[model samples]
Target: MAGVYFYDNQWFEECPKLIGPTDHSFWLGSSVFDGARTFQGLAPDLGLHVARLFKSARSMGLAPKETETEVERLCVEGIRKLPKTTELYIRPMFFARGGFVVPEPESTEFCLSVYDAPLPEFDGIKIRFSAWRRPAQDMALTNAKAGALYPNSSRALREALELGFDNAVVKDANGNIAELATANLWMVKDNVASTPALTGTFLAGVTRYRVACLLRENGIAVEETTLTESDLCNADEI
Candidate 1:
């Protein structure tokens, strides 16, 4: 994995060891991050991804030292350091270094990593419905792209993979369809595309929003509404 990382006001070819045992983020999981992809010299919705990173930091109770524009600029600069034709995953992260049970907002630190990660070929994936469910808004930090929240998703994904499926379709607390364990969910039925409506249970991914817009612009009807397992079983495409 060829990559470049920017941390502590310097760029590094190797990922620097930035966290330790006592670090708030390492122990308490006070971290937030966002991923954006660049391929063939085009990065769609990079700005939106950067903006969401800051929002996630705030939601996680960490303060970001850099503005969204500055982070986005750093991302582009990092991309330029790599081959233009390489497909890359751009990740910007914020973590807290201080506080015991609660993270100190002033102890936030930031890092940016850009790495070669080719997009997966579209050889359709097998998905199974998972027993795991997303937490209600009050039960967890559902609004932020926080690392603490991923363990549940990891468990769901692991369960699916163990059952010979590529991914799992997770549900919200009410047992309504929420999303795939790793990404937003979408289905097509009767020539209309639909996704689970934003219900504060899952992150409304940047790519998902972009896809919805593109579909609508191309004369397809896209709907955001509550979805059920029955809908998934009957969908023409997913």
Candidate 2:
């Protein structure tokens, strides 16, 4: 695992800070966050990552402090702060502080923190069919990468793990497959690729976009359409 971390200029400190005595993010689950990576000494598709973060913040009505250019610079500088020879997983978040009682962005405080953790190795995942379905946009901020939505994912994952599976594949309210607990999913069929379109029920991931583009560039016809559990289990001979 790498041993370097990075954050914005605001949280560019030597030590971590305490948070969430009664934070709304902890209590009411009013927060949003996004993850992107840097590899081979460069952050691939960095601008898109930062843009998504801002989009996530706006989706949740949060006030993000850093511009895209500032975030881009900080990401690079953060890598420089780490040892030159180490591979790193860079994460940044706009969190809430003192965000209880009344959850207003003006009253909210924010910070960023990064740490060294191994990138997950998904050779293949054994997914369990989750009974816990995702909320509709009418009921939850399902489209945004909000902290509140994770509890459902966490519960589904915990249930799946208890049942001897690696992860949970949650369905939408109508019993359509949504995605894995964390990452978006793709199913290959007949030398072409297909994935669930970004309905209001799921976050369209940055990596997912890149992969689709790469596949399209390589002459594979990538289709954005709804996929079901049956579709995955029975993809035509590829």
Candidate 3:
């Protein structure tokens, strides 16, 4: 794909060296990443995504070497390097490059990758209930956007695919509806929209928050409350 990646104060068309075999992040999954989109010369909510990346790095105990302004500049630079007509998934990643025992935050490395990835056409899809359930707060570091949390999600997705479904609706530890395997879950009932309240089981995504705010500002009532799988199956829209 036509794209560029920035690391160690330089940009590359290929991946850069940020980890080694003994790195804590490589062995124990002590890494975090955040993504934003660049399309039509607009990068909506870029600052929020960057801030989240910093917070994720800190929460995961991986020190981020660059400041928020520096990261933003790098993102803009990488996006500018790409073809103007190409839409891209702008990714900023942070991970431990070296450590023994536990990951040392001071050893963190950062990278920004802007690659062409077109937005897909929107069509209706199906969601199957997955056997995997979201972990409770004490079970995993669900508060952070850490890479470790994805394995369970990957299992959910694999299960869904085997069932011939487009995605899976995952449940929280208490057996309440948490979210889709990848995105946040929203249900519409009697023309009113509601999503599961943030209960420490999943990442409360930036897009989900923005969508909720937009709907409320435009006079469509949106609610954040506990949801159940049955609620989704019976809802007017999801």
Q: Higher TM-score: candidate 1 or 3? A: 1
Candidate 1, residue 201: the lDDT equals: 93
lDDT of 3 at 98: 73
Flag regions of model 3 displaced more than 4 Å. Answer: none
TM-score of candidate 2 on Cα atoms, chains taken together:
0.87
The candidate that wins on TM-score is 1
How accurate locally, in lDDT, is each candidate?
0.95, 0.72, 0.88
Question: Given candidate 3, what's the lDDT at residue 81?
Answer: 85
Q: By TM-score, highest first, what's the ranking?
A: 1, 3, 2
For model 2, residues 139-204, the per-residue Cα lDDT tens digits are: 888767777788899999999898988988888888887888877877788787888887788888
lDDT tens per residue, model 1, 1-238? 9999999999999999999999999999999999999879788999999999998999998988899889999999999999999999999999999999999999999999999999789799999999999998999999999999999999999999999999999999999999999999999999999999999999989999999999999999999999999999999999
Stretches of candidate 1 off by over 4 Å are: none
Ranking by lDDT: 1, 3, 2
Question: Best-fitting candidate, measured by lDDT?
Answer: 1
- TM-score for candidate 1, please give it: 0.99
lDDT of 3: 0.88
